[model samples]
Target: MDRRLFIKLLSQSALVSYGLLACPYLGWAKSAFDYALEGQELIQQKNFAEAIKALKESTRIDPNSDWSYGLLGRAHLGLGQKAEAVAAFREAVRLNPLDTYSRMMIEIVTQKPLPKLEKKKKPVSPLEQEAYSEEALMKSELKAEEGLEYQVKRVVIDAGHGGFDSGAVGKSGLKEKDVTLDLSLKLHEKLKADGKVKSFLTRTGDYYVPLSDRTATANQHQADLLISVHINANENKTPHGSETYFCSEKASSSEAEKVAALENSVIKFDEPYKKKAGYIDIEEILLKFEQQLYWNESGKFATTFQERFKKWLPLKSRGVHSANFYVLRMAKMPSILLETGFISNANDEEMLKKPAFREKIVNAIARGLA
Candidate 1:
């Protein structure tokens, strides 16, 4: 079956597969407000395990509150317990069908094929919980390297596509290039304000900078890291999330390939423009396989970025993925591409338009890179 059909079947099976949290233990006295407030605070601090505990307590205290379950799902997502996340999100939707966040999150998680959750829901297995719990703990206790503090002498921010390249336009005409440019400008300004870092743009105006040129500019400057920003869209408006990608020789799955195809299409300019390309030699693609070191580092930064971003925006965290992206493949240093959000999704489009939300995203990225 096609992806849409697969997703539909997945969603239907998911709803029938998972049930509400079954509790045989005595309830706690924690209030819903207490759980939500404390959970939100812990999540802000990137303490997802503790946030899950707090949210769970809230749900135990008030089983009727869908907000608690939804928040619990967010915490589990941060911890990478996709199965538990799907369960919690499903419960949230069952409790309150009107909760869009819960519904969206459920669909996203289910699409990835999470295992059939236990009916008891009492921390499925300590081993699985421990793995994600450690991740949350490590993030909370983050420490800088001995002499490798978030040091950046030079930085390059690449706005995915521009002039003559409308990029991926949604049915509503929300162009990827426009959002990427505005977001990149915001990121540039934010990075520039950091006295320790000097920022440069591959292309500041609405002009197409060949993918090769974008990476070449960063490599020439000896950039500490390069960040390419773009927006994501899909055939179905239902899928919405923020996915970060790092370069790898491993081919992407069919879904990822579709996304890459849509994004790469932006750079297909006229022949005259193609002749001036810096990355015309296909030989360079093989060199990417040898740069596994940079790919590993880029993956680290991508993970950090997605974790920080999900705290502010309610976008689903699609995790750090690897793909043979041309923009990333040619880069000499660590490079990451951020698929901000689905511009095609009405809810996300509304959120993307807000200045406050944009600033929050920019600030999160800067902090993550720092």
Candidate 2:
């Protein structure tokens, strides 16, 4: 039987059978199921505005339905409401932790800038919520300090891509994985020698680490901060600059989103998250809330790092951006990703190959952290 027809008949049967019982829960389930089906059909017809209305009602009727949230996200995306799309998708992922599609959508939508809405007061995106919470937490911590010194003393440095995952390759044969690993090592040594901060590298040698494991290592170490380093690339080979990124539920721009997508492409290498037996939903919610609080601090630190980094580096500054990076998302501490330079650009590739230039890059990061 056709899947849609089968679903329609099943829904009809459910409504009739439950109507005899006059069960309130059954009424809600039937209505939600019907609305979800209608919304999905409208989406198929490209009637996004109507689909959104139907999906919203579906979600309101059954707030725990991951399917409804996912559909709402799709409708929002279709309308170019990126921030709303991200929020909806995030809820879907929270409800159904195994929903990889919703997780991927969160990554994709976050990389692009939030569209300007005509409304007077704009709704806060998840990124903004995180930043605000982080700011509040920092203020409270500082108030508690009462003149005591505060500092980040331990750090994690992750070199993007490795082993068979060569990352982007330059025309001059310089691989992104090698460059990132070399730079990470140099930065680690510099940080260690500074005596002010202790640093650890996610990988000390050329080998692949799953995107999820990189952050897992940081959380295990109880690190104060994490800096993920990478060499950027573009097909045009004209874009060359240094950019810093912090985790956000929505991307700051289309270009920023694309950069994230490229980095996240390594998700193919990741093994699925092992489902824990008898997981508590409240615990997961609290964990996510705590992570959101750290993101604001990450954003502030990223901006500071970019300012310090641009002063010493030869490359042009692209400034700071925010996007949903799987590597940055799970870290319990402030985390940022650095795109040092575009390997695809001829000039930047040559600079990246030189030891002096690499040392300069290392110095900039060390100084930035300090």
Candidate 3:
């Protein structure tokens, strides 16, 4: 591929900023993550040389930081250093086998140079040009991979707010934790019985598994996908519907922001909160640049998921949204959180309380995955 194949970043609006460290945003001192963030900013400013220096410090602090390595690749790509970019991207994919973004970049770079494209009547922006190149390469790659399809053999189903965390409550006294567990159990069973994909559950019973552990479980299982199931709620009790969520620093809407806040409220129980929140190691920097790519892919998957999930449900489809969900922040693979219905809504709560309705929701999930 030509060095200018990708002239722009993943998305101009995607992942503008992230909580790079655990403590109080970025404190006085800097961490490797801070350097990485600086590198990202430099790249945005089109300062590839300075970006490379910052990213080098990031890798020097933690040689195993795949996301940082991937950033190094982008910086190199920005400088039109094809060999250097390939090296960085390869190291990233090596450190994290599931980094499809880096892997795809490697393939795109090493493949034969793209044929020259005719100039358009309207001048294209860097972002648009990058998109066109990616689209062309992705189509070619998809065709060669498996006719634009892949068989998902492994899946991790997470039941949100286990143990003492009674996620949400309805007027009828239904518990969100209980509902999610039941739905996840059924979804697991159905996926197993269908003989299409092997499924794993984050928690087998009512035990509080930390948010980090949930994604860690998926990584340990080497799962192809992670689906954290949760029931929605609101004080107003009016927003009653099914919506899918993928992770993003900037929430797609206010409703999405609120939903993410509600789900991420349990993070206070996690161990990371104990740290001083500054100068953390690279192993601990879960949210990386690669996450932007994964979240973008997650958004695409959420759309397809909603299309399939809404077919078997009686609830209104509220469509797909993006928010910075803690549980979704660290997933190495594409991950999504499913808000089946609002438990705060009377009709939704009533339906959620029924066994038959739970079954339908699980079936809908299975259908969505298929």
**Per-residue lDDT over 232-342 for candidate 3, one digit per residue giving the tens place of the 0 to 100 score:** 999998989999999998999998899999999989888874455543333332236457767877887888889989988999999999999999888988899999999
Tens digit of per-residue lDDT, candidate 2, span 116-233: 3344554665544544565576679777773433266999999999989999999989999999999999888887777899988899899999999999999888898999999999
lDDT ranking, best first: 3, 2, 1
**Candidate 2: 10-residue stretch with minimal lDDT:** 9-18
Model 3 is weakest, by summed lDDT over 10 consecutive residues, at 7-16
Error of 1 at 32 (Å): 70
Q: What is the C-alpha lDDT of each candidate?
A: 0.71, 0.80, 0.81
Clashing residue pairs, candidate 2? 110-250, 110-251, 111-257
Worst 10 residues of 1 by lDDT: 15-24
lDDT of 1 by residue, 231-285 (tens): 8888788878788888777745777777767766644552333344443222232
* Candidate 3 global CA lDDT score: 0.81
Best by TM-score: 3
1 or 2, which is superior by TM-score?
2
Which regions in candidate 2 have their CA more than 4 angstroms from the true location? 1-150, 276-278, 281-283
